[model samples]
Target: MNNRLLTAVFIAAALYLSGGFTHIAGAEDGVTFIPKESEIVSAATGKSISVKSTCPSGKRLIGGGGECTGYLNTLGSAALTINAPRPDEGAWLVECTNLNRNPGEIRAMAWAVCADAGVLEKNR
Candidate 1:
């Protein structure tokens, strides 16, 4: 029930509600969501780390998110400074800083939600 967990839950719920992980029924717009995940990175106290999830070829990034997990620090848990889509790079970037002063590890992962470029064009 920490900040990081709450943030992750919130993101998951939002994605579920928005159908970011499912195909729409009877919709033949050729729009589909492809999810990608980065390898987990662990950071020590007072350290920072960054990770990215890149979409496969022919896919463009639409949305993304990240997660941080570990023991809480004196102030709080690790902070997510960036959780955004990198359309130019066709990826999702995630950065986190470990504010914990004690001895522990903070792990982070990046998630990318991608779709056909044609879908993006249609929406635009």
Candidate 2:
């Protein structure tokens, strides 16, 4: 699979394991998958940019991912250097570098999946 697909699968698995799944009917499991997004940031050619998404009050981050856009080819694509939960467990951080030779701009953003901490305990 491609890097994007693999990353998505990994995030899904992490969310599932962390009790971030919501019910089909949206019933109260106290579990909520809150997707927090970072503002789009530009990375210059050969330069790296980092973005972060933080959970709201009373929510804890379970998993997260990121996207890099505006690239020429596989070799010139923006490569993600870091895509993981923050040490505080309340945010998600993502960093990517622009590999294009030209001084073009690339966009990168982070996504955070959050859930109620108490809900996680109840679900377990």
Candidate 3:
């Protein structure tokens, strides 16, 4: 059935897309991508992404990514800063807090979209 085929295709795409956490979403920065800001939240989470931000503040952007479990990503490499005077090849600044909690080797994947200026600019 067409519906079944579409479902299969979707699943395949998801697996292929999420296969690697490294290449997903723009740099770990906390900035938003000029073109695909929404991508940050699209397919960017998994059952393993137990850790997440609280009351996030930033521009209206989107991203896609996910987690595998046992991996803890830091903010300096996770948040995206979109307020830079000029953007790079879409590499936003990703500042994060360890929370001192990790899934333990399994590693979880995740992404964010926002205009974190202070943190990102200071570090960048």
**Model 2: lowest-lDDT 10 consecutive positions:** 23-32
Tell me how far the alpha carbon of residue 115 in candidate 3 is from the true structure, in angstroms, after superposition: 5.4
Best by TM-score: 2
lDDT of 3 by residue, 1-124 (tens): 1225634653454334334434332334444433211212212322122323222444432332323222333222222211222122222322222343332223322343334545333332
| Positional deviation of residue 76's Cα in model 2 after best superposition, in angstroms | 4.7
lDDT of 1: 0.62
CA lDDT, every prediction? 0.62, 0.63, 0.31
RMSD of each: 5.3, 3.8, 16.0
Q: Write candidate 2's Cα lDDT for 7-115 as tens digits.
A: 7786677656655766321225443454434344455677777778887888777666776655422455777777788958588887777776655555556777666
User: Model 1: per-residue lDDT, tens digit, 1-124?
Assistant: 3466756875675455345656331125543444344344456676777778887887666666776655533346688777777888988887778776654556567776666656545533
TM-score of each prediction? 0.63, 0.70, 0.23
- Sorted by lDDT, highest first, which candidate order results? 2, 1, 3
Relative to the true structure, candidate 1 reaches a TM of 0.63
Q: What is the lDDT for 112 in model 2?
A: 75
